[model samples]
Target: MGLQKYWRIVFVAVLLALAMIYREEAERIVNIVVSSPPWLFFACLFLVVAEFLLQALRMKLVFSKNWAEILRAYAVGLMVALSFPSRTLGEGARIAVMAKELKVKKEEMAAYVSVERVADVVVLATAASLVLLEVHPFLLAAAVLGICTFLAVIESDTVYRKVSRGPVPELLRKYIEESRKIVKDRALFAAILGISVVLWGIDFLRMWVVVHTMGGTIDYTAVASLVSLAYIVSALSFLPGGLGVYEGGLAGGLVLKGVPHDVAVAATLYERLFSYWLWILVGAAAGAFKRENGSSSTA
Candidate 1:
């Protein structure tokens, strides 16, 4: 980690300590997860393994023609993603690993990784729309309806042709053409989208299990949307795997949806146990082994 990140974490830790001390309403978060049933604890473990498998499948699909490299790159991506914040560093880290393992160019790897992240955006938007409908019905419904009408118009060749002909300069035209090529590649888009949906679904189910264990009244789908929004916020926060921010967002979302505060806190803690901590332990071990085996780059 960089010095900047180190200091930011320190700052965040201090702030978190203050938050815990001053916020009288905040229940003891860690204690709740500790008291959850053994069966539920195992369920969390199952979910993490499922999450890793889904990511591996996503990477494999991202590079369909290069299955062998995909396997290596996927593992590398998971390691980096779990070790860092929001998986933001995952692509570059994977590219380095791919270069060593498969002698591939970083630029080519970048094109695939870029497309992979765009897939994530599309999935998040879809999840957000679903969640908004559940969490904020009126506004979400209007937005969804308006977006659907807009997409329908865009999908129509007549509308596209009309929009395409106008004041487009040469440079802008080339950019548009390239973008069209990227978007129109149905196989590539399908692979990315398919894997992303599956990954998110597993995560949602994991969240659902936590609520079930806690005996919370919130529905599975409702928990899913809340998970989606919490994920988005955590991504924006830039903390490693979103750390404190993610847990806080999960708890807050549940409270907003009328869950009792203690249950929300317990559920969020359980989520960390099953997902974040698992990733940290596994990814860190993989990273350390790579270093010892001289399989990783120091640069």
Candidate 2:
């Protein structure tokens, strides 16, 4: 454990060193940030708050829990996700914490988490495919076909029964039962997907605002494509908050879209400042608050 801790520190140090290596670009990023209008910063902050609230709402719909507990779990989860190497662990932490908080079985919570994860990925991929329609028709078709197939399978009772009768573990069977309950409710399923769409739309808007704040311009479609691609790359990279990978993908993609390198860097940094770093702070505060209330617990 100690060796792993040291490796994490060394990894972060290397990332910092790389940032300093580009002296001129780093200076430009600082200047761009300093010169940006204050209102835009507040705007981005508001969007972040909105995003979290929406996320909590989605959780409420899934878990049927009180608002306070749901938000606290979500904040703690976001914190863990940003601080850790893989998002899967953070989500697992969230499922455990929330299950304990609600006094429910972990398998039950895990079912909802699984569905939410799939819905989010499907929504993101669909958005990316639509944006890339003209540029990559094959990708659009594949994304569409994949999403449809997944939904059909999840909604099919025959498949669910067949899996249930198979040599599935008892815990996974419980999870599957819960998942079937969720997907069986067409209204609930649609509502969750709707929330996901709105959530991702806010993300795209936030990115657009960040770029404009840096005095850069890009169309909304381009912004959607860029943000989707960056997130996909980051999620696959499994880096904490996508970290260097996300930053690189966003800035490089923006440059490819004709934005200046400095501005692209500035936009990426500023967007991450609120979307990623700020959430970490919020999670810390939530964890501290829960602890202070004598409800401290670990995932």
Name the best candidate (by TM-score): 2
Could you tally the backbone clashes for each prediction?
Answer: 0, 0
Q: Give candidate 1's TM-score.
A: 0.70
* Model 1, span 183-260: residue lDDT tens: 457775687678888888888888888877786778877787788777767766555667667888888989888887
Best by lDDT: 2
Sliding window of 10 residues with minimal summed lDDT for model 1: 171-180
Question: How well does candidate 2 score on lDDT at residue 288?
Answer: 87
lDDT (Cα, 0-100) at 171 in candidate 1: 46
**Per-residue lDDT for 20-107 in model 2, tens only?**
9987777878899899999988999899889889888887997777888888888887776676666666567768876776778998
Candidate 1 stretches greater than 4 Å from native? 2-28, 64-72, 82-102, 130-185, 295-299
lDDT for model 2, on a 0 to 1 scale?
A: 0.80
Clashing pairs in 1: none
